[model samples]
Target: MATVGDQLLNPESGWQRIDDANKNIIYNGNWISATGDPNTYAGTAHYFTLSGATTNSIEFYFYGTKLRIIDMYWSNRVNNVTVELDGVISSYNPNNSTNKYRVIVFERLNLQYGFHKVKLTTTSTSNNFSLDAIDIDSNGEITAPPLSKFLISSEDKHYSITNEYKDNAIPAMTSNTSPNGIVDASSFYTTFYPWKAFDRIIDPNGWVTNINVLTGWLSYEFDSPKTISAYSVQAGTTPVGRSPKNWTFEGWNGVSWIVLDNKSNQSAFAGSEYRLYTFDNKVAYKKYRINVTANQGAGDFLAIGDLGMYELDKYISSVDTSEVSFIKHGMDKGMVIDLEDEFIERRSVVKENSPLGLGKVFKQKIDTVKTPIKKASIT
Candidate 1:
């Protein structure tokens, strides 16, 4: 009895065994049995040999998301084999000086779920073709997500203005004097380093100083829904008094904000560095916000230099084009008319034209024209 190592067939440790004698496998033409010692051939019972027949082939009908072909490789007698997976032919040549058995001849991963077929044909009569077994993953394959392109930052910076931050103190000298007190959060959106105290480098040149309010918030809206799992925040220049000490991360669920992750009594770091937070589960959302409830030193304002979010995957959905209008030039007004006289002239038939013959003639005329034409153009 053959056993699987991890029961999971992945790119790293490919497993799930199908021996040559499996019921789902079919061998055509004459094949010779070449059984080896258990110690020499990875505890495999038997192997089939093919030679001197171009029609000789082996077919496998399998239910798996991925398939891998295993065979023996030897320089002296091993021959080239034609591998076909789901009707696609892939040629493989095995030539090596050392006799290595149980080699992966070919593999296809991330295929559509359901049953698929694989065929291997012997192409050389002089060389020997050995059939070992096939590796398949019945658990199905995982599709990797597309790469993300959005970046979070303040306004006027590269790929900025796409994110929004609010309810924070505007850094001094960088605020616009609106009807309300100087907007303290302006410096948070600038393209400056050390935007917050927790930044890797403690630079006080630019920061978003919160108002005398204890609880502040920063929020960002992405252009599209993204699967995010981690985020980071740079504290303000004054780590003790203004840096956020306790905060909660929330994501918009189309109706209300839901807490994704939260941390309580988070101590302030001494220097400027981003404090990273990761969620155990991923959330797909377009909006994310961080609510800071307390600061390190009982300060009136809570300052943050920069905020960042990392996306885990992209949302995959199908688009419906049935309602879309696709207009082809010269295809709207073409009319097909069946002229009994024209059909008689073309086929030289004198019988009275029936409605079916007229309809056939009309279809023929339309097919011949290929493009729409004005009714006046028809003779």
Candidate 2:
């Protein structure tokens, strides 16, 4: 049969031992073996004493979500011991009349994930303090999934301009065109030709098609397929019949243009706010095309200020919550102590080293008890 000490030291058994002999496990005084009798200890010998002074203490560092303190219990000459977890102090009194060995003195579970420190100090010198071992729950490390990339239409660099309103001073269907057509050139009524609706600009002075074109379209291409859930389009200065009224949003899934959203009879007021649209189902594609079939007014012209697309936000659905119980020694609960100063940040640096062209990840503090929200999703 495996001895109690054997079980406490076994990694497979989910118990980690911190004893007097460990160099990292601080001990302020001399080590002494138990004497004077009918011992209740479970190992080679019963109780062993590690002499403690009023100021004597043992401190150690650990990384986990839960911690448990184990110590030897004797009724005869035991004194009160103080325990601190991450600087929060709680006292334990091992003054029971019965002679119990290898008892749990204190335990704290469900702590935030990260590195932690624990300290045990003797408050009274009348009797010596006995520390047999300290056992920690084995499963405490956090395993986070790889971070994802944030996708937005602004990041795209390629597009296919269909009906560009060309001007002698300004380029036609170029990304440089302001989505709102608000550039300096737009101040002149005759020269106020904006680039094209697909140029990603919202400048009020930007492009607009000649009044009365039966049908028109603009296509955008990205380096990789992206998942889009919502889109918005700003109307140009001419919000009358020149604005698009009926249109279809399509995506190229490497095969054909798949219709994502079909809007009809849409209205746009000249110099009014942008019109926004959301898709019921999200789809992934490398190319997106907007086909305008009808204009708001009888005129065939179509005016678009700017256009944009965005992906949905992601979140963690679940996390691991396995529990590991600690073997009781003599650690007590409910002894009040003053709270220590809160931990302060020593420095700030990038959380991860991502690929040169890929996006980066930022560090954030989170509550383990609540579900965490993530801005992006992995492809």
Candidate 3:
């Protein structure tokens, strides 16, 4: 039996360890383990403590005739391998989702007999609340699957020109993904599957698929950035009947919301009906979630037709804030930031090295695709 973290056994849970000593303080998601040394939840994205998955995520299952649910979308997600009741991959979703990503729900998702993998190709600058482990509910207890064998499989270098309107790379799958076109370039104006958008010829967003509701604030998660003068958003139609609102003129000020002068809270369409919406300037974000506060619909009926973001970052000023994150962890004993200008000129990236221990935790790889950053190799 795998022992869970002390923090997860909060006062709310039914099960608790009677003999284990509560020795560590769980603040900012880290503290000393029974081992005594400070332990950070610095395992893989979405994955919890390196020892196991319970602390950081939920598990759903039962043997023979059992069901399971997997909670998801933390950071730098590589893959989602839904196992069949017999243990083969029934479906998959990979290195996707936006930065403010929360959870990805899989339903009636039957699984089979074997372990699975969620290999990530990209990484995020931070991690979020993973999970307390999977929840299982069955008349008879089901055995958990074996530890999944996973590895970061490299892919062939694929090349492709930028899209007609954007500079996004629609590279073909080397090994990690499938379909050069499906995963590559797309738009209502262009391509289609494995190499396409979530909803292509399938009538824009998969209104016929899983989603069923939309609430609270509305959001749109894009794969790339965009450049524009102004954006226009519309909800339901002229009257708020069975949909959201058809009001436009809402705006964003680089960071958060910039309340515009236009105000049209049309609840006529807020009663109960499906609606389609669009934007004129096409404002963008990686993920767009509209928090529903009422029973507008039993569940989320968001008929998402697209995903996009601002064309350009335009936030390049000076004094990268990331330099601040490094300051908190403690830097090289004699290293000084005053000479940062002479060290890296064009582009520099640092990766974690000692993923398990505290000794040294970084290595780096840089590419001068655009700017030329200088680098140094310590003797």
Candidate 4:
């Protein structure tokens, strides 16, 4: 959308003007540096970020009066940074004055797509931290006039589609029918998009394999609480590798698991750990999922996990709108920033261009702020 006041007044080509006053990407930039400098906390400021190129979202606004949201920090990729705002994206600390003017907003931090380097650090050492403008909103990923043609699908083990399809996208893969795997509501897959919902009737003993899986089924039904108090199966393990991940709400409520979580065995490879599920509350079974596909056998760490149902008052609607968060940003399509809306703005002032009529050519100028005749008790 690229227009939030021209991306908050366009500045951050990758922002790295760390005028080191001593340990101050955080709090000391409040005052102090005219010449009596003293803000050094290992000063090695940074910048340079191609990394996932911004569709992950970043917003900006800064005024600076008392400015002290715990000094400052939107820091990136290391430990990431989220002082415990609990929205879960990364790196945010609003515990001082809540940064009224020194406005600092944070957003989803799903990196690891391409080049990586992002920096806005500070321990706040006081160089009089002055930065009033900065904006970088990227969905960046379309390089050149390259791909004229690139076909795929095979004839060996499973798939073989060929003609990779793309002529403005055949009205979303079909004009009157086939949506490929389905995603209606006019958002015709809006470039392959789908909200989380899959049901295999709650992974019986566990299963996934429908020839690599495109997608299907998603059901819901509940009501057995007049006699059942607990049952669990809260799986949400995106563990990270690829393909739909998030759904770790394991089951079993005869005793433990007010929520019970498990990453589900996602092939297990790199740093693999949490994958578990033991809480079988005698199997109350209703419905649940998270088997994106692929189980021909043997290790599979590509990653994916979803399937949750915790009933009470519907148990907060079964806590899991499918926590799906993503943004490829290249093939097009995006706009999602809601972890308390970590600063995302769009729109650029383009509505004042309607005055061109020698003889009423496409006209629409009526209201002149004239609404006065309300003569009921006025006489």
Candidate 5:
């Protein structure tokens, strides 16, 4: 008899709460935090409030089987709330004639047990919206996985980028570029150097290209070869039009840059908005970069608040057993076996039997040789 709103009625076990002000949640647009009645809201403190706006949204990622959004239902509140769970869209209206607190605005149950991303947006243009808290099922303890180490972090010496803007004429406020190629862009605007994109801070004054720079490139060099399967890009504080609209994700494979993922005509980003893109990639490389070919009609410049590249856990999909062979003893006939698994990469020449004839044999390079070799009898 589990209830959605107000866990007091039928408290469900293993369901933990995530407050509105949690650092893991990303709030876009003008979201204000205000104090609310302890009895009315789930928590005793503050809740997020938004008034009279559309295109405003909030995103949260959780690892659980069920999710509950604790909001409010009132006359002035938002009439339409659009929920996007792992890219699937749904909508609900929380507008009611009477005030109702601790209401369950949206909930998804029995979801595939894994990590999920949910985005709640205000679809109604001219109404208010409130987010009290969020609840998710837990196994041992309710703990969201911490942000993984990025292959393009500013703290690590192993990670690096191209270069930063260096022009005395422009007079930068502070240059955070590194000589070891930590951060750099094709072009930058004064204080808005390229390093800010990898700084992990979502601010308006992030990495910005020069005005009228329609195309730009940002590259990263790793200390060792890294296999990246996913990446994320966050928009700056304002002017979403400055975001890159079309781009190609490339990796350097000792010779030339190979395109890992290509995107075209992407949707415009919201202020401080974040987006994650994943692709199929197995090869590891020491260098990776992004080549931006177009921007979202930002004839002035392009901007990026943050950039993160991630290497996911690798798993063996299939095993190759064709190269493996088994030799049985006590047989009437002797077989000449040159197992590739045992004799490869030795860097030495090995003399093995050949099917050409008894007088003829072939030589191959292998690391180890079978001791006490005997002549094979060919019938």
Candidate 6:
């Protein structure tokens, strides 16, 4: 009777699992991303290959002493996986009569603590091969060549919008809308302002455009330039058809708006569904915008529950310690303008200090405000 942690299959502790979606792994083949298997998988997603002729393989560069390869074990899945670590090869057969998800098909331990490459290849891919996730030593990390250009989200100083819908003729702050935070949008419906999308709320009340305003945009301006590589959009409550179907994520130079990513004819979203889109963006930009052109057959308006931008992972193996030190030195010298002062002047500020170690203390400050910029209708 082999238990979950028996036979050194799955580690019971001291292991960190990295999802298949992590950019560190290089997948070679037409690997399809899928979910909703009969049994739950790691991160509820897996990448499966369809081609039997092609040399389907996946390579993970890691710095660790132990590793575990997780995959799907199911009936009719006839494939032989060969895992090559530092030129040493080992084989495993995941084909089983019973269905199981997140099965540790391969495990290796007590390796030299240094950089290593693990290449998993399907030698006899009579059917298909599925990769769920990989587990590594708790102290080790996925090590790869550092990316020169990536995008990241930093605190911005300003936001703007173009239009907003109001139910009554009076112009005053409502209980539903915040009067503080810098946000701007091209258009919005009653009580649903652009800042609502950035408020970190997952409720029904979100940013909505005026009726029939198909083409609109929401822009943000940062105090300094930032490299952003990914963005996410969360669906609002009910009538998901109102979500943006066609849109261009753009960054603004001094002269023009450069399209970073363009999506069209997107499927309708489910309520509060969060979707992430990643693209290659190396250059830093001071301004960014989401210009939407169409909705998912919602003839009345466009709505979004939330939106967010992200930067590349600043992993220790991927980041230069000297560069981080230089940035910190510049900040300590006041070479980079601190937006905290201006932010605190306009809103409530909270500060805290905690002791880190003997004769060492850490300080943190938080500023909260809600303010919006100019708005204009796009007819």
Candidate 4's residue-wise lDDT over 177-267, tens digit each?
Answer: 2332332221112222222222212221112223334333222223232112222222223322333233334222445433343332332
Q: How well does candidate 1 score on lDDT at residue 267?
A: 42
Kindly report which residue stretches of model 5 are placed more than 4 angstroms away from their true locations once superposed.
1-93, 96-181, 315-379
Model 6 scores what on Cα lDDT?
A: 0.62
Q: How far is 274's C-alpha from truth in model 2 (Å)?
A: 1.2
Pick by TM-score: which candidate is best?
A: 5
**Top-lDDT structure, candidate number:** 6
Off by over 4 Å in 6: 1-181, 314-379
lDDT of 5 by residue, 1-379 (tens): 2344333312245466666667777777766676556654444333235544566678877766677777776787777788999899998887776577666667776564545768888667666767777777644123343332111112221121111112111112233434333455788887887877776678884888887787898766665787777777778888878888899999888889899999886656767766666676768887777889998787788888777777654211121111110011111112222222112211112244222221222233333355543322322
- TM-score of candidate 3 relative to the true fold: 0.19
State which candidate, 3 or 4, has the greater lDDT: 3
User: Please, what are the lDDT tens digits per residue for candidate 1 over residues 1-379?
Assistant: 1222212122233246666656557667666655664532344433344434568777766655667676655675445778888788887766566566666666665454444667787667666766666777634321222111121112332111111122222222222332222222322434532223223344542344434565666665555676566676765444445767788888889999899998876544434445556564345787677787776664455666666667533221222111121110111121222221111111112233222211111222243267654322222
TM-score rank order:
5, 6, 1, 2, 4, 3
Model 2: per-residue Cα lDDT over 1-379, one tens digit each: 1222222232224345554344556555554544443332234222334443456566776656556665545575456778888779888777666556556656565464345667777667566566665666464422222123221212232111111111212223454333222221111123335334445555652445544454666555655666665666666654445566788988778777789999875534345345555564446677666677876664545655665666544321111111111111111121111112112222212334232343353334446359644332223
| TM-scores for candidates 1 onward, in order | 0.37, 0.33, 0.19, 0.21, 0.42, 0.40
Q: Name the lDDT of candidate 3.
A: 0.27
| Model 4 CA RMSD to the hidden true structure, in angstroms | 23.3
Alpha-carbon RMSD to native, per candidate: 20.6, 26.4, 22.0, 23.3, 21.2, 18.2
Ranking by lDDT: 6, 5, 1, 2, 3, 4
lDDT (C-alpha) at residue 28 in model 2: 57
